[model samples]
Target: MTTSPTAPAYIHVLIVDDHQMVIEGVKTLLQGEADIQVAAQASNGPEALRLLPLYPEISVAILDLNMPQMSGVELSRAIHATYPQIRILALSMFHDYSSVTEVLEAGGSGYLLKNTNKAELCAAIRQVAAGHTFFSQEVGTTLLANLVIPANFDRTRDAHPAELTGREREVLQLIAREYSNSHIAKALFISERTVETHRKNILTKTNSKSVVGLIQYALRYKLIL
Candidate 1:
């Protein structure tokens, strides 16, 4: 009996962002490639978390830092902690020296800016999935030029954990995005009662009296975008 031909392996990817248009654009770009597939798209970190379990073949995650629930940095940390084998590609607008450093330090293998072309983005996914580091060309030039600063290196070495949990930061970011508790719960796939619990804990941890105060704290500390 003749056997059927095997399909080529495709690099499964997850796109994590809060914006619909960005997701659609990336979907189109990835779909055109024969060896790649947009396995899943998430609107926020919490939603991403829920979707990740279903995509066992997902090889890379393209993350956006400015989501309503969890920022990219926190999501990177969580992914590294849980599914250590999955590669993370931080897709962000912060191609600045500090931002790139933050993503790499947080366990991301690739960093690309929003304006990167479709070819470069696909190349990046393949590169990172194969255990190579990739940075956007524009960001790479700046990064190479600035990598020699002694002070910058020292500051990166001195980084510390924020005195907040990932879930708490997720709540704070949703607040910054002007999402209500009910909305946050819906987006996060948690019940309203659970969201309220997280909110109370976030307020206590940040010492913020209310939602407005929480936003002020986040912006002052440069935690939320």
Candidate 2:
């Protein structure tokens, strides 16, 4: 008789925020998820850095954008520069495009507003931990609203738009329309994993480094029009 396969291990996470209440709240929300475990909590970037060595199993970090001494952007940059393996998720009250862009540019794997519900927050954490980008519904909409696409934008800088598979096109359009992976997965009747795969493929074919870049490419090529 053969033994059954072992279940996958939980992804350890570190929560970093200046506010003790915020950290506790996030920890509470994450309590019921069997696939996730909170390994530590830090009040600031330096504390987080210090705790990293103590908990080397942490695969994801949920960070607050505003903190004393070192802001979330600074912390994210520092963590990314030193520990490239830890994925970051920025949780902030700000929904502005600039703040979101800064977090992403700072090497955050995902961004979600502080008002996010527990379910969405958990989903975002899992998505980032699994190596995919996640943007809250409002955050994505705000980002698209701030973009200014030129009427005569050229698409010849990259490969032909036709090179994208049909699935990739659908995923790209939904992403431009500000749909999160879970939403796209539901709408397209596919798994969130499949949507993530399509997103990575789309980025590769378009040579886009971020979601903002991908949206610009879509507009230039009329993929969203």
Candidate 3:
């Protein structure tokens, strides 16, 4: 007589937004998910910080970019510094690179536009809780659109594009399209570690500094349209 395996614990979430309606709407959307629970809600950054102590089970925080006194970026930075274990997922109406990048630099694990559907919101929460990054398709598109190339930039000065293998090119295209490593792995039928290795190799071969640089490289070499 052996006991059955234990069930996985639910991912506890804390929703922080200045608008009460938005918070309620998010809670309603998450209510039907069996593996996710809305543990708490806050109307602002200070309130969120105050409530954090009371809800230690919260593993993910959905933050709004704009708030009255403390912006989501500031709140994210504060929460990350104090509660590094809690992952932050930013939900914003703004899809611009500045807002998205600010939240990310402030320790957000993911970013989703306010127009995100129930499925994406839940997926983002789950991914962030599991220590993975997630971004909405629209956000990814915006990031690609905003990649700036210098006026005098010369591709010849960088690593030769021919050095990338076929698999490396595919990985670069997906990365330019803003697909997360997990999504790329699933699409390519490879392990996440393999996808990561491809990414590192691509970066090295292209002599790219960041995701933006990779996208720029892909654009210049026509690796991705």
Among these predictions, the greatest lDDT belongs to 2
Clash pairs, model 2 backbone: none
Every model's Cα RMSD, please? 14.7, 9.2, 8.1
Per-residue lDDT over 62-173 for candidate 2, one digit per residue giving the tens place of the 0 to 100 score: 9999999999999999998788768899999998878987886777878898888889998887777765567888877776677654454465654356488777777776
- What pairs collide in candidate 1? none
| Candidate 3, residue 132: lDDT | 54
- Cα-based lDDT at residue 95, candidate 1: 78
TM-score-wise, the better of 2 and 3 is 2
How does each model score on TM-score? Answer: 0.62, 0.70, 0.68
Tens-place lDDT per residue, model 1, 1-225, is 112112237788999989899999888877778888888889989988999899988878899988776899999888866876578999887677777766766667678998888899988888767654567777666655553323323344325323777777766666544355777787677889988998888776655665544543554466664
Superposed Cα deviation of residue 202, candidate 2 (Å): 8.9
- Is 1 or 2 the stronger prediction by TM-score? 2
The local distance difference test score of each candidate is 0.73, 0.79, 0.79
lDDT order of candidates, top first:
2, 3, 1
The C-alpha local distance difference test score for the whole of candidate 2 amounts to 0.79
* CA deviation > 4 Å runs, candidate 1: 1-8, 149-225
